[model samples]
Target: MVGLYAALELAPEDEIRLLNIPLKRQTEDIACELQVVKLRDNPKYIALSYTWGSPTSLNNEEGAEDISSKPSRLILCKAKSNSPAEPQPLWYRIMVTENLYTFLLKARDDESHALDFYWIDTICINQKDSEERTRQVNMMAAIYQSADIVHAWLGEEDKDTGMTFQLIRALASCCTGNERHKRIEGLKDITPKALGTRELTAKLGACADISNWKSMAMLFHRRYFTRAWTIQEITLAKKMLALCGSHTIDWEDIVKVSEFLTVTSWTRWISEVTGSHQANHAVPNILDANKTSGNILYSLIRSRRFMSGDPRDKVYALLGVAGDSVRGKSRLTPVYGKRSVAETYTLAAIQILEDSDDLLLLSCAEGDSFHTLPSLPSWVPDWSCSRALGLGVTGYRRYSAAATIPRTLEINESDRCLTVKGFRLDDIVSVGENKQDILSGKPFPNWLLIINAMPPIYYTGQSRFEVFWRTLITDTAGTPPCHPAPHSYRPAYVSWITSKLSACVNETAQQTGDSTFINALGALAATEIPGSPLSSNRPLSSHDNERPGDSKNSIDLDEYETTFSHARHLRLFLTSRRYLGVGSESLLEHDSIWIIPGSRVPLILREVNPSAFRVVGGAYVHGFMKGEALESNPLFRDITII
Candidate 1:
């Protein structure tokens, strides 16, 4: 055993102990030793980030014991008396994981790497002490940041582990300076087919190789990426090194490769080329680490896939990286064992909303009709529920008039209820079942059938009626048609639905040999005379002659096929006033549509009581979209929801 020196003194309150790596391996009963020190002493050390391998597997290994069942005990170290006049040696006992012990022993024995002290959670913190564990977990961000270097241990290396690190290093080296910038830009513009081309393949080096891509993808599949604490551990480190058995790689190289692989269209290309056999689940999170900053709410929501033994730690573990303003507003003090997981999550939601002063968090809410956890309020998203659906609408214009609404949200902490001041736009008179498509397995059925199912609206003539279905299906459902310059600047909903459809149909007809579909579209356009009373009042042009099968024009069958395929997921619902809506397949009868204050799209709400409702999810109601509801004469009221 190493002798304890009495030259240094530590404060009684500073109970953190650092594991000291012996100079050489020992044949004694205790293979390693620990040195008790104060964190206030500013000791230089390395922090470890790793996943606790399954206890069953670990316990079965030689020299491994089930420490989880053992009670924690304190070791007392008596310093050797100076000149034989002082007392004997001090003794202390600390509990640590078998894997950590193995890592420390290896680091100590390796001549190339000399390690003195380490801050590992399992050994440093007294896990049996709830208060101490809470305090230590809360300080993880600082501990990792304060370390000289953070080491990520990805278990013992396998046959392909060295290949994974080598591949990442090669990729990082290739993507640098002026050449790298051009490659990234060129990759952005490259089509899916071009990914496998000789020119592109040579530029990306081994990364373009299907075998290397599979190995790299499998590397990320390691369990270290799925642990909740590892997010902050890697993010807060000033410098980090990833260790896989004997192989090592810089953390920045791993991050760079991850970012490169996550480019918008590249994921699909890689997944397809690789046959989707490799695990790419953790790639998104590695990318998110570089993008998300200081927004703890965003981090928490994004990290829902991460696993934690204690549910409360999901929120508590993230407090270290949360911004100062968010922390102040949330005022979450770590008190393990004092509150239930439900209470902790509910508190986090309330505090986040109060701090952000926006309802963007509500966008993460799960549909009440789908999966509901017992005892959880509908408004408070259950972070533990991994199956929550994503926000229905995208491309939210942040500066839009509807987004600027001044609404105050209040939380009833005791009852776990939410209150907000907003108007009731319309009551849901009827809701259609989720339409299913046989081809794509999506909920969106035929757009024409959806619109016709609604009550008849006033029209100038039968020709005008035919035009409505054609425009709404081909334009609103498929892709909005394109129009002349001045008309293109109209309200987003109107301009979007109108211009894209016309352009898609024209382009689709001019590129494909599907004369049957083109003739049907042309006949519908011809039925409506030039001077008909259309919503936009724009006359149908003479371009009907350019339909598919026209000798002079070429039709794009790809776009034509894509339009029908994409439109299959949308289902239409009608309110009592005949207001039309397009939303998810989960929509049920009597579900109300509401344009909540800060949300980008109107949400579907299910009535729980006379006036109280639970959030079903967000939706795209045709006329009510694009802030139109805010200008309408609806009775605004303060409503309480759970």
Candidate 2:
């Protein structure tokens, strides 16, 4: 016990603890032994990655409840004595989560003839000693990267999991290495104009059947995908296997499919022919090809969906995989007990703000949402909260409201307030129904009404119809946004407008002035027609709206619906300054928008008092996306955000 504790403090570059699980015997409790070996000696070992606590979703797989909610059980770890005088080995009963114990049992059985050593964080690190825990934590990137094999405990298989994995393999066929080469050959001949047929609707509908569709959602809904710490573990591993009971899935297979899904839609929509699986430009943000502020901020933005018990772990776990620029600028260490989560997050925020000349982190600060940490300031992103969407959508950073301008800020650490210089961009004069409300089959005429009541789009010389379409898609298309979204998307947008209007036609029973706007929108939706010249004279007929597949534009409408997934989480707004854009769903009627210098996108802010404001999150204002509002005599004021 004495030697084991001292060895941790003296841990060197090559030193690591690997549990040696003896061959399993039936009807016996799991037991293990430890060996502190030098990696330079090339001791082959497997690393296990898992969550020690309950799922944030609280919807654990049935019968795997013990894996998440079971109380910790002791595992006997017999270690070699420090001296020969003490001939017998000393025993330590280290507490292990049931999930860890389950892995030990399975690994012992599976590897009884295959291997002997395993590396797991819980028992390996002395959780009681903060310094030892932090030291080992800092070495996680190395440990995971060095492992012979990384096994992710995704929890025991549910009834649907086997089919889910089978479905994944099937859908992933087009993205397989062989198909990648074949797709590229076909891609050269398939122009963006011809890719509309690339919807792969019939093919997608086949593999993405109703059963498989629900299974796919359930697969992702599993707790394993949502852990923040696992981000680095998954990214750095040379090879990983996601295990659910006896079922095994190659990590590469999952990624190949995910990358395919993330790319194919927007890649085909754009001029780029990136059908190859090796194209890193279309890779996940954490595994991005380049090491820059883009890697750090972009991954952080995407991580809002992942969970961590310690808020600080949200930042610390990701740092292991962040670009060198981020790790170098923010020399952050995982000090578990010294600071409050708010203080730690603020420190991380300050470093991130200073790292990127622009306020890239600003895009992550979401609107008022559910947060466990009450002390967290409004300006700082509560990474634990899913929050809502923002301008940080993939490739959205290209919208440079303060293009190339370095960020400027003065943080009053005492109160956790951030003050910055910027001009008042606009004030929200009218805000339509939120995404949830509109998508819930509620009154969409309110949206039509709000737009009808809006003042002219005098700033950009764009029409109401033009701004309406552009704002919905944040005025950009593609995964990596392509500016002035292709004209091909117009018919799709009009098609979407018609479909939503048709669903709520029954709302006419409780008709108000909004009914007239609904009638007018049907006409407005006809502004664009597929395979025909753009004009508003052709009104959309009832047949086109009701029976979707019967219309020629149905394919384009489905394309718009699929691509418009991000906008479904946002609200469309018209400002007092005559600006139009999509903003946070938490937006209100009078929220103000500001263009802070060094910030890439416009910020939606709500005033709390004369001196302070609550951040309502970032926005995608049309016309002003490219620093359009910066006048020669631009007025800059130090606005304080809580």
Candidate 3:
């Protein structure tokens, strides 16, 4: 950690670094200095957002300088000069990181770009001073928002950067309604010899060469998109420019291309033409910047993949770009060393729940059996960890359970408990271990082993297993109607399940033939037989007796196979009452399924002590998820969760 003991206090407003860009000199090297100035002064400046690469490797020596040996003070010069007759040089001592020093040198060298000042975090704030660092971090939203332009420096360019930016600009131009034909003409003019010799040009449909798409993908894959701080830097800037070495592209053009690629079937098209599934992986992060409203929880969840040196920055970095409602409710002021990581995250969860007045935040909690912070309640999500457990894949689905009863959920911080008014739905009685192969990205061959491992009750009749499987994949409530039915009356769950499964199977079969389809179906059927372990090669009666030419038999086989395939994404769990549901993979046997009043889904809670429990994860209990528990013998109790 960077530490500073000396304090240099400024006026009570947002103070930012004002870079004194050195005048052109005949010398090979020119030194640039930075000073602090209030943002209210309306300085014409550009804000830089870049990642601080990995730490410099230390030299091997008997006596090497360490953190303590480094200089404790930085010389800061004022941007403005005093009268020439009585010139008085003023300097203040502060600390600066090596990364900031390199950035300053680069900015000074780029004399073509005119700017009176610049605001960069490392140099602007006295990082050693906790109070100043906290104040500046809290005002980051305003600092970036007030800047004339935000310059996104993507580090030194590589050989392909020029071609990448050219393709990006050309694709962005194609998005303009009137410039489509013009852009097409421009692309046709520079068709690479490699593309011109092949049929790729014709296949691209007036867009840039297919090979260029690979270059564009490489550009987006830069570390710039993966940093948590850049999200707000690009989103909040009034006018932004992306700089890569000598090349530059407008931020608006990048946003336009992102929007265009997302709306068009760009990813599918790229895969079809170039046979590359990874072509558009970075497009989602670019689109995230355009999202201005809705739940901030989704943004926070999505940003977990991003890296930050300081763990607290995972939440602090996003407060600026988060919506007004979330920003107001969270009210997360950055307090550097005073609060522990557990306290920061715990407080964030409490505020979100209190503000939304719902249990949606609980849905984001994944089970942490070995809790990183023992002081933190189980219900609070450990944002520092990368494991995504609760709600599993279904958490991302856009559907909420019907609201039939009023819920009042409150947190008792002093008691370290969460008190909610709701009835216990069921207790988890059995849970199957998540397949290591599937989690490791390998195909799981035995779906039946998982099903057969469940209690016999799940395999009886139409099977509650089918209900659980149907709920996991399709958003039944969000499905469009088939005709005469009113908007409010959605299709029955069973009918919707059959239709969706048949559609998926038919589509897959159409793409790959009957041989692959039958093989997949046989594998699924082999799992349903009694006493058949996952490794058993014995073919079941269902697979052996199937008539390939029978349409009814094919549909039934497809439905079963499709359901099994979807269920592979979820872990099967049984309630103490023997009720079946799909839950987080980390769920354990004693965890309780709860239907809090405002929650759209049931949540899993694990007991910590006698009366207090912590959240294990969330669940998709088939029968009770849609407020059914509230309708049947509705009883409210003070449920204490810690």
lDDT against the true structure, per candidate, is 0.54, 0.64, 0.55
Query: What TM-score goes with each of the models?
Result: 0.69, 0.81, 0.70
Off by over 4 Å in 1: 1-15, 28-30, 54-102, 174-183, 186-197, 204-207, 269-292, 326-331, 369-372, 387-389, 392-401, 425-587, 620-625
Query: lDDT: which is higher, 2 or 3?
Result: 2
Error of 2 at 448 (Å): 1.7
How much does candidate 1 score in TM-score?
0.69
- Output the better candidate (1/3) by lDDT: 3
The per-residue C-alpha lDDT of model 3 at residue 600 equals: 72
Clashing pairs in 3: 4-128, 74-94, 427-576, 448-527
Residue-wise C-alpha lDDT for candidate 2, range 551-598, written one tens digit per residue: 443246545654555445578788876677887777888888988877
What is the per-residue lDDT of model 1 for residues 353-454, given as tens digits with 9 covering 90 to 100? 777756766656656543335676777666664321342122233223255676567788888888876665666665543423322222222333334444
Q: Estimate the lDDT of model 2.
A: 0.64
